[model samples]
Target: MTELQDTGLRRRADDAAPSITDLIDEETVQSIAQEAWSALVGEDEFLVPLPGDLPEDAVSSWVDVRGPWNGTVVITTGRSTAEQLSRELLKEHAPPVLDEEDIEDGLGELANVVGGNVKAVLPGPSALGLPVVGDAPVAGPDTCRVDLLWRGQSLTISVQGTAGALLDQ
Candidate 1:
């Protein structure tokens, strides 16, 4: 191949993949935190990693993207935190009171709102699955976690929820 062609190939190789720092860079974290906090808790604060004591009843909502970029974004929070959110968000409803069903709904909405905001900045048109709630932290491959603390309550958001093909991507 000609020198010009070789140089072009080398440049492409150099820029072939996203760096680790670039993957979970400040911009991505800050932006997601901004959108999620504003939608859920009214504002965003200094977000830190998972604390020593993570609250129980933590729920996670995730969506799987199957195109150019593949992975999932899962939003998590304590059950109590979710309850507070239940009251806060449910105010828009007619009665403004939450029940067991409402808590599930609230969890979905929490995941949707947070995931939607994150999805907006992500690549494009990927299948965002329904939010999933459980007793433990959701784990996946190549995940970048953004745990949160709001009003003395702790919450978390897990990016990249595929154990097999997560970290590499």
Candidate 2:
């Protein structure tokens, strides 16, 4: 191959970080969240594909995925909704009154479950990081986000590529 052609190929290879939109879609993300909610929260629970106003005090949980498509799978909702979700997730095992740690752990677990499933469908040989609770990482231009309502409360799930990764692309 000519030197110019080889240089072009190398540049293309170096700028090949995959976008989340290319790997997944809103419907797929909602389906994943629905399945997770049904299994973890309750079989009767449903996630309505309708957006509602998120309360001012919102909390976020996420898990980082490292691979050809590096990004985070994040879930954000109001604190009250998160607490309700925690109660539902714990069900019979939930304490009479949950503390902050319990709430965070529950949200984090949900993120982990959804993140694991998201990783499975992405390019092979990826690593999923442990769940985190707090403000979510900034999302880049290439993101697939699903907005839904669970029990009339707003919730969102986002598969977003890291800013740095997208910048490289």
- lDDT top scorer: 2
The total of clashing pairs for model 1 equals 5
RMSD of 2: 7.7
Q: Report the Cα RMSD per candidate.
A: 7.3, 7.7
Report the lDDT tens digits of candidate 1 across residue range 43-95. Answer: 54444554435655566555555543455666667667677777766556625
lDDT of 2 by residue, 80-130 (tens): 999999999999999999999999999999999999988887655788999
Clashes of each: 5, 0
lDDT of 2 at 158: 87
Worst 10 residues of 1 by lDDT: 1-10
Off by over 4 Å in 1: 1-15, 19-23, 43-52, 92-97, 136-139, 162-169
* TM-scores of all predicted structures: 0.67, 0.83
lDDT of 2 at 109: 98
**Candidate 2 local accuracy as lDDT?**
0.83
